[model samples]
Target: MDVSAETLIKLYVTMQRIRLFEERVADLVSKGEITTPCHLYTGQEAVATGICASLRNDDYVFSTHRSHGHYIAKGGDLRKLMAEIYCKSTGCSKGRGGSMHITSAEKGLPGSSAIVAGTIPIAVGAALRLSAVGGDGVSVAFFGDGAVCEGAFYEALNFASLKKLPVIFVCENNLFSTHMPVEDSLANPIIYKIAEAFKLPSCRIDGNDVLKVYKTGQAAIERARKRKGPSFIECMTYRWRGHVGPNYDVDKGIRTQKELDRWMAKDPIKALEKMLIAKRFLTNGEASKIVTGIEREIDGAVAFAKKSPYPPSDEMEIIRYLFR
Candidate 1:
């Protein structure tokens, strides 16, 4: 399917916003302004942007710890996202969910969880509900390669396939789970094979290319809307920063300088910016203006979160029930 220039540029902006948003949050954490553990999604923007691009406003999305891109891609408000990271009352979770648990039910983002593979079953459950109600909407579960080893992911996949539910399982195989590399963790690195065993339609693609990501995701989403069995997409991407922080070199033992430089050359934000210029949809001046504008918006979000008060401790009891 041909994506219009306007639509492509919007996706680029969303990806850039996600990258900058996470960067700013990391900076804030470094400066002690935000005291939360943040899993940055610096280089994996295309996977979320591409998948979310294919989804409707009513479709559901479940995310994992590395969810800033997923949340932003699915139309979560940046101001609220920043507020949640800052633990302010204006946050999407009312200052309790922190960086890992951002949620926007109105936008079909039920939430991201800290537990690995936890959202897989949730996405399956949502898909079952949508199928039962005969809704056109689909559900997407965004998880990492490590999550596949979990029993919940397998069970959810089996259920989704058996019921022919409208769900998409996006496995972002960044090749690492926390500090461990994929080679050390899984004997069979080919995740698509696992999907094949389940007889689910699946494909693996270069996650660095936003257009490729979009095309594959679009096809899968179209199939899901037609009530086809679940689709699994394994995106081969890289993370520019460490697993949980801004320091790119903090975990040098697992990631070498060569690998980092190689992935840096394929940065999603830069790739999209170059595409926009080559297509003449965005001039150099326009691109600069867009970056400046996004920075300003992020700055405003930080200020809003900083100025907003945290929920009263007495209200904590009321908030606890919402999680249940």
Candidate 2:
């Protein structure tokens, strides 16, 4: 894959926006401003930014409980997302759907669900719909490693392969299902093998490396767009926080400090920054300016969400049947 100065800058900006947005959300949740169970995608920003960079506006993308990074990567509005997290009336889901359920239909993020692998079949069905229409639309499913153990992931893969649906099943293998490591949960723990069994092409890459993720994603997305078939990518990454909170004990037995330090060395944002500097895309000063600008934008979004009123009591009553 060729990297130009402009493309590198765009990636840097998108990753920065996602990182800052999640950091701010963590603060908001910590302060008790947001009541919903919040999941921050701080350590997994690279997967979303890299993969979504290779997609088009019309291509569908599905995400899991830890979905903020995917939503932001697919051109979702930060103000509306923050509003949704805060449960304000102006939110993307009109404040009814909290953080985990955020969606942007216009950007092809139909919605996310709490159930693991819930969106796999949904993406497959959407891919089938696109196939019927003979459209160029492709669907991407972002799920955790735990979701791969679910019946839905395998069933959807089989169905999509039988019909050659234009879908990309991406497993964001953070090595844990909530508090438990994936090893304790499954025998054949490798996600790519599951896709291979379904007769689909699969690629396993270092999810922390943004360039590798982007290149692999580009190839898979291109294959799907051409109506060849579905593809799978197992992204080996980690989440810095607990399964459902902002912060936790670093010395906790669930995750070790040594692993954290190793992953920190491969920070996607910093890696891209070094690349940009080496390529002369921008100097230290320019990079600082860009970071400052994104911080300001995120602050503005937070202010917008905070000032926005919560849903009226009667309005909440009207939206109870949204799924129906």
Candidate 3:
């Protein structure tokens, strides 16, 4: 795919937003403003941005715990995302979901959950609806490498294939399931190949390279839109922070500093910026302006979250949501 200058810039901007947003959330969580556990999506921004670039506003998106990147890339409101993490009423999930359970109906992001492989089945259900009702829009499920171990993943793939539903299963393989290395957890460490057993077209791509991810994602999404059933894209990426919390997981020797550094060197944002600058698609001045703009947006989101009131704590008021 010949990616244009505008697309490249857009991808860069989206990745920057995800990176900055996650970084800001980490800072807030560190200061105790956010009381809940947050699984930061620090390093894997490319997978979401690249894939989401192919989706329409009406296309469905289901996300896992490390969901901030996906939500932002899918066009969910930044203020709502920040406020939700702050447990404020203005949040997309009405402050009920916090960081891990964010949702945005208007953006086609129904919800994200902390449970392993929880949203995969729901994404399949959405795709089934799209197939039955007749539409080209596909449902996408964004999950970690750990999700492949879940039975729901296998079942979802089977059903999606059996009925020829339009769903793209995107596995962000960051090489670790929480603290444990992916190699130790799965019988077969190769993730994308697993979809082959279910007769779905799948492949592994470099998650750090946004352009590659976008091209491959476009193919998978087009396949689903063509009613060719599900396609699995295992993007090999890495997360910079701990399994849960603001701190890096290296303190307990969960992963060596050297290993972390190696992945950090391949930072998606940095890589894209370098490519854009080298290609003369982006100048140094524009790069600085882009960063400045993104930082200002992040500042605005933080202020909104800080001022937003927390959801009503009264028993009756809380129960009202259950009825709705």
TM-score of each: 0.96, 0.96, 0.98
Which residue pairs come into collision in candidate 1? none
lDDT of 1 at 174: 94
Instruction: Please report the TM-score between candidate 2 and the true structure.
Output: 0.96
The regions of model 2 sitting more than 4 angstroms off are 249-251, 315-324
Clashes per model (N, Cα, C within 3 A): 0, 0, 0
lDDT of 1 by residue, 1-324 (tens): 678999888988888889889889889888988887899999999999999997887999999999889989998899999999888889998887998999998898989999999999999999999988986889999999999888998899998898899999999999899988888888788997898788899889999899999999988988999997799999999988888877886356877888899999989889888988998988999888888999999999999999999877877766786798
Tell me the TM-score of model 3: 0.98
Leading candidate by TM-score: 3
- Give per-residue CA lDDT, model 2, range 110-206, as digits (tens): 9998999999999999899988898788999999999977999889999999999999888999988988889998898887987899899987899
Q: Rank the candidates by lDDT, best first.
A: 3, 1, 2
Q: What CA RMSD would you report for each candidate?
A: 1.6, 1.6, 0.9
- Mark the 10 consecutive residues where model 1 has the least summed lDDT: 245-254
How many clashes in candidate 3? 0
